[model samples]
Target: MGPSSQSATVTASLDQLETVAAQLFPAWLPGAEGIATTAGGGLAAVRSLAIAHAAGTAQYSPFLVDLAVGALAGAGPNTRRHPPEMRAAGLARVIAAALGRPGCALLLRPPDDLDENEALALVRAAQWLVDHGRLAVWISSGSPAPGDLLPEAGIARPAGTTAAGRPGPKVHSTVRGTVRCGRTTDDHYPGERQPGKSRRAGRHGKPHPASRTETLLEAALATRPWAVGRAWNHTLSPGPLVNPVRVDLLWKRERCVVELDGDDHRSAGKYADDRQRDVLLQLDGYAVLRFTNAQVHDDIENVLALLQQFLATRRRTRKGH
Candidate 1:
């Protein structure tokens, strides 16, 4: 994709490639941007990296592949909102190899009925970068979710906190790929849309363990319009509740909670406890939507649309009240 870190003396070699492509590669390299430079800076940068990477002169790392493919992700007539399609695209072998497993996938994914193929892939890939270490993702046309198939293979996200006291953005750096938090995170940077922007459900923490279903419902309330498109990754709590609810997707602005009801919620013993919890949530004025693993895969759009209509009706009723 962009730069080859796998080559010997990656930094030094990249430096030489940069010199050759001075007018090309350096322009967008932060300091290079806005500053004056020689002609063909961008082209030269791409050319140098491409040539070196193409030849054995540079060690071809996934980093380079990701850089190249990502450039297409943003620009090019072929650039896309959903990356998996672009990834599955039968283009350069480097793109295929760059779009490798684990790196370009998410441990958790959004609903199955995703709209834009490339964007979905990008979201999945970005989430992977956050959960695991950032790796290179090559551009294929539409292939998505290698991570789901290879959860054991991802690079574990480096251990540290951001300046904000949470896992900071830029968990890893890339030569070409532009990385940021997924559309699903609670805290979006400037200009990024925050759907649950109004509701003050104390968004600082993740879902509570015993109360995961409760907190996730609150979070889903914020992402109502695109609930089905939302997700959760970072761990907010770790408790006795095995396989706790990790994310809550909003179908509409309705206060509905769609949890990945596993054995914990289905088993006969835990059924009573789950019902009691649901009763309490209703007392708090939440609808508390529930879905099984089968529901998510078999009838996603139907369930999501139904939930949206349900929420819409509920909102109307609340206002009327």
Candidate 2:
């Protein structure tokens, strides 16, 4: 048996935390590949686990801290396969936990009555969590949230921190080197072009404009300045389709198009739709290219290079046009 000393205080630093997770993660995550980013994980991960717990998931294994932060940060990895609602719910729970609140069921399904400050506090907290992703905590995978995982007794915010008068029942998220919520500040968050949401799936928080296309475009942006998507335009002679016909990727002036050929694109139903769309757009003189998902993933760099060549050719063509 290990030393059984009731008096021994065991403190966990970020280093200690990473060590524990490194040993535990591999066993828990079977067939885990590549380098583990756990050493860099921090508060965002911690906030997420609390969220997973509150979401009534007894098994936190399914919802790691990194996954939660990814969802919050709009950075998806393999975790995207999970339902978006799960991510949303996890984010919600994390915010509630940050405020020293338990039983987040109440926040989502609040009691019949809640005061003005209580309601405002809730909104401010969610905004804070979403905007300022726990950048200080480096681990890109999973880490613990700051403060008590479960707040003990009466809630607390930093002393003399409240700007809008006396503190309410809500616990504020105190980010190091970041402006605290439920207070006044001139601080603007990172991401000059970050999207904001009014509400999430059955959860009270701001969601972003992140969709499947946004994610794909974001991934593409890392390498290439151009990405193709099914976009709509009303400037055509026939005034475009009834809705946006999937154009894959369209380089306007240079006139290029790219397609993501998933199984859906091969199936008769989807293929027919795609062919009709492609035919119409092609008739409009758009230079089209196609690639499979495997091709994109297997060699993104090569694919991006091809696109750069296309863009260059198109630039010349546009000059002629």
Candidate 3:
């Protein structure tokens, strides 16, 4: 296929993925709290977790945690000395940091070589999280199967269909980015690119792969003279006391911020957080224009036109003042 055709195919696949995610996530997560088990294994399990983590709903904030790396993986012989309760506590802290809100749900992927004792420990840890932390946990279907270890009551076998066939390269690549094993002391998850790093730079300073939405928007903006001086992923602090906010696109001189939100923003907690951030930006005399990732994927021309109009108006308004 030609380059344009390949791009179009990827965009269509992403749209379909988003639609499937919207339908399946609500049934899998149900509400803001409790533990459960989802049906499916292998790529299906990965797809479900990836979509849930990437596109959350109004009721729950979902995160994908792999038990193969970081502290959680210490359940092996090396860390067998630590009690399961202590291990559970460590897991809980990681979850709390990743979700950082009520109605948090974890889609856990157990290691493939999980033994009976390790399975039991995870089951106990999951129960502890649900009881003490009020977290909703879903152990995705894997090698050992979470159902065999978990209590019947904790098993939530929701019936839903996921997107068939393999996802495009772009969607497949997001799996690693969406899953979290642990967090650093700075509150950023391991492997997350820190702010102030050039957008073009990936780990080891390699050229970063831009998302389809980002690439399209950047191309559109490049042709427009007025779009110059804008920044991508710029950090702004409204005040010293308040924490700094990183914006997707910023025109500092015009005081205009454009945010491209993913499906996760539709979740109740995320929606509230976005509103709060917008308020802080507004208070600091900046206009915030928000767009969904899907919107940018579907209609780049419309997005660019709206952005042009907004920037022009902002320029005139600032000049008048």
Candidate 4:
């Protein structure tokens, strides 16, 4: 075959592979009897049976071998192979889709002839998919070990039941909880009034405790700027009737607050709310500093410098006053 013809053949095979994966993913690996038991015995059932038949006929299934080779091929004059980074990204998106819907499945076969870096990238992507749970991965030829890929991720092909011995639920449940820090109950902030011990006893009591992000900011301050335990809770003026807003990280002495903006803050409504909060803080004679997770993770030094600079200015202003 000419180079053009070979490339077209490879691309066509990949299209077939994608179609097969889409068809078989929803049914999972229920055997022949299970397929019949399912409503309609559907397209997925037929595809699954076809794949099984193809696999048993040959040691290396020609049906999927071409697709796997094409997936691992490097960029060439007439090749449709995706770059390593792009391949990993595409796989991640597929895995996410599979996870979002129950009974969705995918099979990735990496060619054994891949270079070290290519193999490593594929392995990492596979590892990530398996780590997220529910998604079962099978590495037929180029696997590091027989079952090592599945063991660490607690994933097994043709999974009869979930790790907990129950049928896999469609949606994964997430539990959110608060992390309490500091010493024993006696170790309270200087101004923070304990529930019953404080002289200023009232129905409302002190504002909500500092969040985990605030706790980290406090620790970071202790290392730099030397502002340890300086954060104080300052409730929004005219006070909220319900679930009153409170600054995340505050330095009462300097009248500076640091707000850790998370992913939710990027939403239009939340972004507007954030701007309002900043305006309120500014109007209340306080400097509000905002930092996103990316800034903290990617540019820690700069974030710390900005915070330090804000604190210094606030402190100097307080001293001048």
The candidate that achieves the highest TM-score relative to the unseen native structure: 3
Model 4 CA deviation exceeding 4 Å by range? 1-215, 232-234, 238-244
Clashes of 1: 41
Evaluated with lDDT, which candidate comes out highest?
A: 3
Question: How many residue pairs clash per model?
Answer: 41, 11, 1, 1
Q: lDDT-based ranking, best first? A: 3, 4, 2, 1
Estimate, for each residue in 123-217, the C-alpha lDDT of model 2 and write its tens digit. 33332222232211111001111122213213233222113553212223332111111101111122211123111221111111332332344
Query: Considering summed lDDT, which 10 consecutive residues are worst modelled in model 3?
Result: 171-180
The CA lDDT of each predicted structure is 0.32, 0.34, 0.42, 0.39
lDDT-better candidate, 2 vs 3: 3
Off by over 4 Å in 2: 1-217, 222-244
lDDT of 3: 0.42
Who is ahead in lDDT, 1 or 4? 4
Per-residue CA lDDT of model 4 for 200-238, tens digit only, reads 211122223443444554556668645653643545451
lDDT of 1: 0.32
Residue range with the least summed lDDT across 10 consecutive positions in model 2: 135-144
Count: clashes, candidate 4: 1
